[model samples]
Target chain A: MKTRVIVTLKSGVLDPQGKAVHHALTGLGFDGVNDVRIGKIVELDLADGTSEAQIDEMCRKLLANTVIENYRIEQA
Target chain B: MKSAVIVFPGSNCDRDLAVAFRDVTGKDAAMVWHGESTLPDGIDVIGIPGGFSYGDYLRSGAMAARSPVMRAVAEAAARGVAVIGVCNGFQVLTEAGMLPGALMRNATLNFVCRDVDLTVANSQTMFTSQYADGQSIRIPVAHHDGNFSADEATLDRLEGEGRVAFRYAGNVNGAARNIAGIVNDAGNVLGLMPHPERMTSDAHGGTDGRRIFEGLFSALA
Candidate 1:
């Protein structure tokens, strides 16, 4: 089984890199862009019988900084 | 006071921090490797020096924060041991959840490296008691990710509790409310981007940073 963890900065937290990327996009003449926020994606390959709770625990422990970021787990 | 300086693989300021600790505490500071799971017994102060720890990979200080040594540092911090994190150390602290706020890239998207003016925001902290309130001093900061940000309510509460220990006299980084340094809720942990250790001696161009360690000892006494 493979799992993907998507980590993103929580709303209202300042995202300077995201802002920089947004500025770059605007400079490139991309329109209809409302806002841009940067986040991380971690893909994991787990053995059979890996529980969702275990994946959530991993995300909670290290994949996401709970103080400033949130994480969601997807299995495929 | 006995001290220890955590040395990550890429830590460049570990020796400088150890020298500062020794000069102020009158005892040699142990250089503890980041791979170590336990620190030497009865350490009083722990210095997490600045550097491109883990090569600034996966986010600055992110990988280092999850290292084995940080666990010991966090436990020591909880036990009332004084912990000071500088530059990359500050990033590690925030990543480790030992301090509030995140250090983002500089708002100007530049790596700032110079002696900048700072105002003593709260002299009550063990880290700042040596300086008088509102006094100005200069310290060198070299970092790309030093911009500090927190939510409004947390910022308000930090201000309300007098935990905002230092503020930039000028806009060196785009830190909220000009915050340069802050203390943890228990007041035992401090994380700041400026290199106070580098400015601790007059021979180093200024002794303004000496008082911080002096204040720490005095507060402990």
Candidate 2:
């Protein structure tokens, strides 16, 4: 089974990189860009019978820092 | 005082930290590899020096935090051993859940490297005993991800309890409340983004950092 994890900075957390990108887009004449938030996608190939609890543990322990970011796991 | 410095694969400041330990305590600090599962016996203090550990892969200090040696460091900390984490080491401590908050990229999105003025916020702890409360000192901080962030409640608790050890006299890194360093609840673990080991000697253009080591030695003694 393959899993996709999307990690994003929590709301109210400052995303400087995202802001810089947003600035560049505006400078390039893009219009109506409401907001930009940068995040990462991590794809994992797991063996059969991997439990959801185990995947959640992985996110909590290493994949995402709960203090500053949130992560969503998706099965594909 | 006996001490040990944890050396990760990419740690660049291990020697500087060991030198600081030797100079202040009159004893050579053991350089413990990150792969080791246990630290040497009788270590009163543990130093986690700065560097791009694991090349800052995944996230700053993420891989190194889960390394084998960190387990030992955590255990020692639980036993009330003094632990100091500097720069990347501070990131590792936060990742290891030894300290509160996460150090994100600098607000300005630039790698800041300079000697900045810091105020000793709380001198009552073992780590800051040599400095008077509100004393201004200069220390060098070199890092890209040194902006400290925690939820408002945790920040309030830290301030309320006087656990904040040092605060930037100027807004150097956009850390919450301009915190330069902080101590854990037990007051034995300190995590700071600045490199005190680099400022320990006058030859380094300042000896302001030496007082931290001296304070630790006297406290341990």
Q: How is the predicted docking of candidate 2 categorized under the CAPRI scheme?
A: high
Off by over 4 Å in 2: none
Task: Give the DockQ-based CAPRI class for model 1.
Answer: medium
Candidate 1: lDDT of B216?
92
lDDT of 2 by residue, B33-70 (tens): 99999999999999999999999988999999999999
Clashing pairs in 2: none
Choose the strongest candidate by lDDT.
2
- Two-chain complex of model 1, DockQ on C-alpha atoms against the true structure: 0.52
DockQ of each: 0.52, 0.90
lDDT string, candidate 1, A1-76, tens digits = 9999999989977777888999899999998789999999999999999999999998887778776788998886
lDDT of 1 by residue, B1-221 (tens): 68999999899999999998889878899999999999999899999999999998877898899999999999999999999999999999999989998888888888999999999999989999889999999999999999998888889999999999999998987989999999999999999999999898879999998889899977886
